[model samples]
Target: MRFGIGFVGFACLAASGAFAKGSIDIGRAVYVERTREGVRELEPATSLKAGDKVVLVVEWRAQSPDRRFTVQSAVPRDLAFQRAGSDAIEVSTDGGRNWGELGTLRIGSRLASAEDVTHLRLRVVGRQRGRMTFSAVVR
Candidate 1:
């Protein structure tokens, strides 16, 4: 299955328009682009493979920005969660129902690894292979 980055067409993350007087806006883009000093451009992803590393860049802008924000994204079952360097992440193992830190997560009595995470809550996010949607609110 394939997912679109700019709208609600795909089961992955849906990108919606700016909200509430347009003071704050959120945008989503998935790319296969790696962070390299020599790499000038990031390629957008049209499809995903088994072990592809995707960079999910969520853009947030506001006339007056808040000190903090809580961003949530819905993860597709096909993609496994990967670790980003941010410290403000809470992950869910049981769909989007419950969320916990990496150490606190479990699946049927086994502790969750960085690889077993399903959903990611953070300032920025990454994944293995699946559809995803991102949402954020200024705090």
Candidate 2:
């Protein structure tokens, strides 16, 4: 599965459309940790497989200062989210519409765990650029 990070879709983090001429560009890269010939290395996941330790790197740059917008990225269907770099990040189990803390979110009667997370939400504000890294294991 591909890392299809949802940079194209912007949601409301706090205040939206405050800037008239700001642009955001996102870049995604996937790498798998592996060992070969008694050496450890990270290689492009050309042949993704189950149980592979994968890292999803997301980088974004905002052209204007003090731009507040939402950025969301979906966890690949073949991967299970382990964690992201931010403790203040939000997780969406039901797509990107609804989001909350992982253990606090409920899917019906059950609590939504990291395994149930379908997308990750990060609010971008008070900065011109940022990077987010997520660790996951392919399922």
TM-score: which candidate is best? 2
Q: List model 2 lDDT by residue over 10-117, tens digit each.
A: 221222343233477666677788989999888766666667887777777787767787666787676788988787678888977797887889999999888898
Which parts of model 2 have CA positions greater than 4 angstroms off? 1-22, 36-40
Candidate 2 matches the true fold with a TM-score of 0.77
Name the regions of candidate 1 deviating beyond 4 angstroms. 1-23, 33-42, 67-69, 123-139
* TM-score, one value per model: 0.60, 0.77
For 1-139, candidate 1 gives per-residue lDDT tens digits of 4433433222433223323445445666776544578864557777555555666655555445442334556655555556643556567777667788888877888898766665665542232112223322111
